[model samples]
Target: MESLSCSLFSYPVSKCSSFTRLSRGIVFASRSDSKKHHHKKPHLPKNLRHRRRTELPPDFHPVLHPVPCEGPPSESDSAALPRDYDENDVNDSYDGNVVWESDEIEAISSLFQGRVPQKPGKSSRERPLPLPLPHKIRPLGFPTPKNIIRTHLACSARQPISNQIYKNPAFLISLARDIRSLPPEDNVSKVLDQWSRFLRKGSLSLTVRELGHMGLPDRALHVFCWIQNEPHLFPDDRVLASTVEVLARAHELKMPFDLDKFISLASRSVYEAMVKGFIKGGNLKLAWRLLSAATEGKRMLDPSVYAKLILEIGKNPDKRTLVLPLLEELAKRDDLKLTQQDCTAIMKVCTKLGKFDILEALYNWFKKSGSVPSVVMYTTLIQSRYLENKYRDAMAVVWEMESSNCLLDLPAYRVLIKLFVALNDVSRTGRYFSKLKESGFTPTYDIYRDVIGIYMASGRLAKCKEIRREAEMAGYKVG
Candidate 1:
C-alpha cells in the first residue's frame, strides 16, 4: 500500500493513490472522480466490467454493449456489418458482438418491413438507405428582400417629407406654396426660369407630393415638367411616380396637356415609356393621340413603342380600325423599320378589315425595310387575292411560299384546299387534304364540309367517306 513502484505497476490517476494487489500480483488503482480530470474513463456494465487476473472457463464467451454518444449510427442491414460475418453472426461482426436491446431489435425489424422509425431528436424518419427524396422540396431560404408587403413597409418607413424638415425644409415649403398659388394655365417652367437658385431633386419631388395633397394635379404636372424639361434637373423614378400618382388621383390619366410639347424634354426614352404605359393602361385613344403628336413634332419614338401598341390593339377585331391609322402614320416615315412580328400583326389587321389593296403597298415597304413576310402573312395575302377574284395572284403567293421553303401551316393548308376548290381543281384539293392529315392537323368542320362537297361533286364517294370518318374521329360531325 506504499507508493506503487513506477516500473512494476502504473495506472492513470490524478494522484498516485494506493494500489491493491490481486491473486496474480496484478495492480488495480482506486480512481477518484475529480474536477481536475480532463476525460473520464467509460463506465461498463457489471458483467462486462474489467476483471483482474481472472482465468476464464474453456467455453466462456463475452458480448459487448454499445456505448452511447460514440461512433456512427447503427446499420439496419446485415450485409453492412463489418469484418467476417454470417447468418448465425457468431463471428467478430459489429452486430454479432454487440448486445442489442429488445426495443432496438423490434425497431430494426419494423424498419425492414417499411415502417419508418422516428429517430431521437429528429422530427423526420431516418431512412434505412440514402434514397432519393419523395419529390423536389423547395428550400425555405432567408426572407427575400423583394417581398411586396415588406418592401412597402420599408418604403413607408423611410424619412417622410414632414420629417424631412431638417434637410433644407424652408426652400421645399416655399417652392411648394409658390407652385400651389400658380394658375392652372401656368406651370413651374414659366416661374422656375426667373430664379437661378440651386434646386435639389428631392425638393422638386417634395413640391409635387405637396401639390398632390393640395388636390391640384395640374400644379403637380407643372412641377414634373419643369424638372423634366430642365437639362440640369433629373426626373428620376421617384419624381415620375409622384407625378403620375397625383395626375391619376386627379382623374387625368388621359393627359390634359399635349404630350408632344414635352417630347424633346431630357430624353426620348422617357416619353417612350409614358406612351407604353398608356397602351398598357388600355387607353388606345390616348396612345394613338400621343403617336400622332410625336409624328407632328418630328420626334421619332421607338418603333417598339408603337409596335407593342399596334400588336395589342390588333388583338381585338373591334380595334382593327385603330391599326390602320398607326400604320399610315408610320408609313409617313421613309426610314422606318418594322420587324416580321409587327408585319404579321399588320397582315392580320388588314385581313380582318378587308384592306386587300394595302397588302401590295405593305410588300413594297417590307422589301424596302429588308423584312420578309412570315407564313401567316402569305396566307392572308393569298386569302386577299382569293376574296378579290384574283386566283392567279393567289397562286403566285403560293409559289412565293414554296420558293421561301415555308412549310404549310393549318391556315395555309385550308386556304390551298379552298383555293384549288374555287377553281374546280379536285386533284390539288385532294393532295392538300391528304397533306393536312399527314401534318397531324385535325381538319375544322368547315374545311371538312368544304372538302367533302368537292369530292361529292366530282363523284369521288370513297374519298368523301374516308374524310367523313376522319372528321367524326376528330370530334366533328361533318355534313
Candidate 2:
C-alpha cells in the first residue's frame, strides 16, 4: 500500500484513457509482490500529507486516500492490472435465478430516510410559482337615483304670452265687439291706441264694421285708408261693404272733395264697393253717377260690379230701359270675362223683371263662354218658373239639373217642398222632405217653421204639432 501510494506520485495518469485508469484500479501488478510489501505503506505527497486529519473519522484507512495524477498513464501499470469481464456476456450463456441482497438495499433506503438537513449547493436558482388565472369583471348598472347617472335638461320656454296675444282673430273680433258695445263717442283714441299696438290683417275688417255701426263714417274711412297703406292686408267684402257705405254717406255730406280727389284717394275696389253700397241705400242716381265716372276714367270695372249695378238698376221698374244699354256695353268688352256669379245675377234680374227672352239669351251666352251655371243658378231658374205658376216647367228644369249631375243642396230641396206645398201636393212635399233627411240635412228652427206652416195650411194640425215638438227637442225654440 505504501509503495502503491508512492508510485501514484511518481507517475501521473491525466493522459490515460478512462478504461485504462478504471482497469488499473480493479487489478494489481502481482499477488506475490503485494504480499511481500503488505506491511510497508508508501508516503503521500507533501501537499496531500498536509490535509487536515480531523476531517476524517478514526476508522478511515489511509490506503483509500485520493491522489492527483498528471501526464499519461503508464503502460506497465495498466498491464499489471487484472482483466475486466463484462457482466452482459454471462446472461447470453445461461438462464439463472437472480437474487438482490435485502440488507444492502435497506442500508441505501435508511440513508435517504434520515432527517438530517443537507448543505446547500453552489447554485442559488429557486423554482418559479405557477401564474395566477385571470379574474372576471362585473357589468355596469342602469341609470337611476341609486345609480346617479342622469342630468337635468335645460328649459327652452322664455317668450311671453303677450307676444302671441293678437294671433287669434276671435280675440280681435271680441275686442271690436266690446268697443262697439260702448256708448257712441266721436273720440276714438282708445280704439286708435289698440289699433296701433295689436292690429293685424284680420282685425282690419272687424274695426271697419264696428266703426261703421257706430255712425263714425269718417273714422271708418280712416281705418279703410290705413288698410290701403298696409301691403299685406286685402280688405274682404265685409270690410269693403262697411267702408263703401261710410263713403256713400260721406259723399252726401257735401264734403269739399272733387272727382279727382276721390279717384286719387280710393282704389278700384273702393269705387266698386261704393257703387253697390249706394245702390243698396236706395240711391241709384248716385250709384249711376259713380259708375259713369269710373267708366270714363279708363279703369276696368270688375264684371261683378257691372252686373250688380245693372241688376240693381233693373230692380227699379222705371229704370228697366237702362238695363239693356248696360248689357250691350258688357257684351262689347272683350277683355272682361263674365264669372258665373255675374251671369247668375243678370239671370236673376231678368227673371225678376219677367224678361224670359233676355234670360235665355244670357244663359246661352254663359254656356258658350264656358261658364257652367251652378246649382244656385238652376234653383233660381226653378223659383222664377214657380213664381209664374209654371210648376211643370220648374219640374222639367229640375230633371234637367239631375241629368246634368247637378246635386241640389238643402236650400234647393226646401224651395221644391215649398213649391209643392203651394200646389197643395202633400205627397210630393213629404217625398222631398224624406229626400232632404236622407241627404243628411238636419232641419233647423226656420225649416221646421216652414214645414209647420205648410202642414197647418194643409189641415194637418197633428203633424204640425209633432214637428214643433221635434224642433224643440233638437235644441231649437218652438215659438
Candidate 3:
C-alpha cells in the first residue's frame, strides 16, 4: 500500500504506474499531505503570484457575527483551528456568516436606512410617500354611480305593499281581463314575461287572484304548486283563499277530473281554500270533511268560514249532522265576530237553498247586533222570501229597501223580474224590466229569454214577436 500510494502520483522516488502520467509530469499530492500543506496560506496560481497579499486589506472588515460568543476566542485560536477547516465545519461553528463583501454591506445599509427617491410631483413640499400605487387600479365594469343609486332607490321603494305593482288590485284585475281576452293559443309564459317587464315586483298571491278571476283556477293552482319550490315566494293566507275559491268554482263548473290532481296534492292553505270553495259550490259533504280537518289541525277558521259552511250544510237535510258540529266549534271561539261579508255569504247561500227560516233568523241576528244591513243582504232576503212563496214578506222587504232609498243592484232587478214572471204577473215583469233599463244595467240573454217567456205566457203573441225582432236586431240570440 505504501509503494502503491507513492506510485499513484508522479513522485521521482516512484514511477512504476502509468496512472500517475500527466502533462509536464506534474504531480498530484495525496489528500493527507495536501490538507497538512493548507495549514500555511494556500499557494497562489502562477498568474496571481505577483498580486498576492501577506494579510487582508485594512478596509476589508471581517464579518460581524450575529451568533453569540460562548466565551471570548482564546488568543491561541489559530493554534486550536484544525489544519484544514472544512467549509462545513466553519459554517457549523459560526451559524453561517457566509459572505461580507464591502459592496454587500453598503447595499444592505442603503436598503433600510436610505430614503427612496421620489418622483417629481407638480409641487412637493415634503409630500408623503405615495400610497403603494393603490393596488393596480382594475376596472370591475359595474354601472355608473348615479344609475346604481337610482336602481337601489327604486328597489327599496317597491319593498312596501302599497307601492308594489302586484299589490295594486285594480292593476291585477286589468291584467287578468287582458290575459283572459288573449287567444287561448298565446303562450302564457311569454305574456307573463312581457307584463313582468312593466311591473316592478310580481306577487304569487296577485297572480293567483287574477287567474281565479279569469276562471283559470287550474293554472292558478299550478302556480301555487310551483311557488313551493321557490324559497323566496311562499304563499300566505290571502293567496290561499283566492286559490281555494278558484278551485271550488272550477270544480263546480268543470268536469270532475279537471282539478282532481291538484285536490290530491293540496297543502294546508289549499285544503282551506277547497273547504270554502266547496261550501260556495254547495258540495256539503266534502266541505264538511275539509272543515273538520282544518278544525282538527287548529288552522285559521274565521267567522266567514263557519257561516258559509253552516249555510250550505244546514240547507241539506241529510248533512244536518255536520252543520251543528261546525256551529258548536264556531261558538267555542270568541275571537271571531261575524262581518257584513259573512252575513251576506250566509244570506246568499240560504237564498239558494230556499231556507227562509234561517234567512229570517240571520235577519233577526243582524237587527239585534245593531248592524245596518247592506243592499246585498236586503236583496238576498227578499229573494229568499219570494222563493219560499211568502209574497207579502218579500214585498214588504222590497218596500223597506225603497223606503231606505237603497241602491238596488242588477241582481235585485233580475230577481224582481223573475219573481213577477213566476207569479204570471206580466205587467209587473215589464215594469221591473223598465226599472232594470232605467238602472243603466245592460240586460243579459237570460233576462231577454225570461221576458219573451213571460210575454208568451200572458198571450201577448204580437208583442213577443216584436220584442224577439228587436232582440235579434240587438245581437241577442232569441231561443
Candidate 4:
C-alpha cells in the first residue's frame, strides 16, 4: 500500500487528470488545515490587513481595533479619495444639511441667502394664475384698461342709472345683433357673456320681458328680484305692462316673481299686472282680489276679464260658490253695459251654481234693459224646474215661452213632454203634442215614444194607439 501510494504521487498528471488531482489535493489540505487553524486567528484581505502582536501583557491590547463596516470611510481616514472628489464632497455635504429641512424652510433660507431657487419651469402650480377677481376678468382678445374697469365699476355702483346707458347692455345688444347678423358658429360664447353682463345690470322688467320672449320666464323672474330690491331704479310702466303681458301669454311658465310685491305696486299698471298675473296663474282668489281692488279704486274692470274669471270658475263644477257673487256684482253694475254674451254668461253660472236668486235678478235685468230672453235661457230654467220635479212651474215656463213669442225649440218641447209625463198629466202631454204638430214641427221620436208609452202605461191603450196613428200620419214612425 505504501509503494502504491508513492507511485500515485510520483506519476505525471495529464490535462484532464491534473484537474482531478488538484481537486483531491485541495480536499486533503482543507481537512488537515482545519485542525491546525482551529487555534490560530483568521486572516483578512490585504487592503484591510492589520498587524498582529501575540506577546501582550495580561490586560493590554491595541487601544482601537478596526471593525467591518458598510458605509464611507471617516474624513480622517480618506487619504485614498480622488482629487476631484472634494468638490462633489462639498456639494454632498451642503445637500445633506438641506435635505433634513422642510421645503418651506429651505426656500426661506434660500431667499435670505440671495440665491432664489430657479422656479420650476411651468409646473402645474407655477402656471399663470386665473384673474384674482371677477371684475378684473376681461373677454379673451379684449384687453381692458384699468381706467375703463374703474369707470365700469363706478357705473355699476350708481343706484339709479338707467340700464340703457350701461356699457354691458349696449355691448350685449350689439353682440346679439352681431351674432344675429353673423353665421351661427361665430363667437356664440362672446354673445352669451355679453348677454349675461347685460342681464346683470339691465332693468329687471326688461330682462324679464326679454327672457319671457325667449321662453325663459324663470330666468326672468330671477332677474326681477334683483330689480325689485333696488327701489332706486323703478321699472317703467311700459316695462311692467310688457312683463304682465308676457306672464299672461306664457301662463304655464313658472315664475318666481313675488305676487305680493306686484300687488303692492298699487298703480293702475300694477293693478293691471296683478289682474293678468292671477288670471295667468289660474288663481281665481287672487283674480277676485284684484277685481275688488279695481272696484274700490273705481277703475274700469274690463268686462272680458270679468267674463273670463266667471267662466273659468263656472267650468269647474266644484267652484260654483265663486260664481254667485260675481254674477250679483255684474247685475249691480249700473254703468256697465251688459251685452247678450254677458247675460248668457250669467245664466250659465246661475245654472251651474243653482243660484235661482241670481237667475231671477238676471231675468229682471234683461227685461228692464228691453233684451229678449234667449230660447236657451228659457230652456235652462225649464230643465232646472223639471229636475226639481216642479212640474207646475215647468209648465208655467212653457206657457210663458209661448206668451213671450219665443219659439219653442226642440229642447223646450222635450222638457215639457218629460215634465208632463212625469206629472202623469196625459191630457196636457196630448195638448202639447198637438201644438207641436200644428206648428209644422215634428217632435223627436223619443219624445213621441215617451208620450205613447205614458199613455200605454196608464192603461189608456186606445189613446196610445190614436197618438201613434196620428204620429205615423205626420211622417213619424210608431216604434
Candidate whose lDDT is highest: 1
How would you encode candidate 2's per-residue C-alpha lDDT over 335-386 as one tens digit per residue?
7677888788888887877877767777777778776679988887888888
Task: Give the poorly placed runs of model 2, Cα more than 4 Å off.
Answer: 1-168, 181-186, 194-205, 214-244, 249-257, 264-266, 335-342, 365-372, 382-396, 404-479
CA lDDT, every model vs. true structure: 0.65, 0.62, 0.62, 0.58
Candidate 1 lDDT tens digits, 233-262: 674766786676566545576564645456
lDDT for each residue of candidate 3 in 142-246, tens digit (9 for 90 to 100): 757654322233466756543455555666666666656667676445445545434432455676777876678766766556545444455456666676677
Candidate 2 C-alpha error for residue 328, in Å: 2.1
Clashing pairs in 1: none
**Best of the candidates, TM-score:** 1
What's the distance in Å from true for residue 362, model 4?
A: 1.7
Task: Answer with 1 or 4, whichever has the higher lDDT.
Answer: 1
* TM-score for candidate 1: 0.47
Distance from true location, Cα of 451 in model 2, Å: 19
Model 3 CA lDDT for position 75: 49
Superposed Cα RMSD, model 1: 19.8
Q: Which candidate, 3 or 4, has the higher lDDT?
A: 3
Error of 4 at 186 (Å): 17
Error of 4 at 265 (Å): 5.8
Query: Which prediction has more favorable lDDT, 1 or 3?
Result: 1
Judged by lDDT against the true structure, how good is candidate 1?
Answer: 0.65
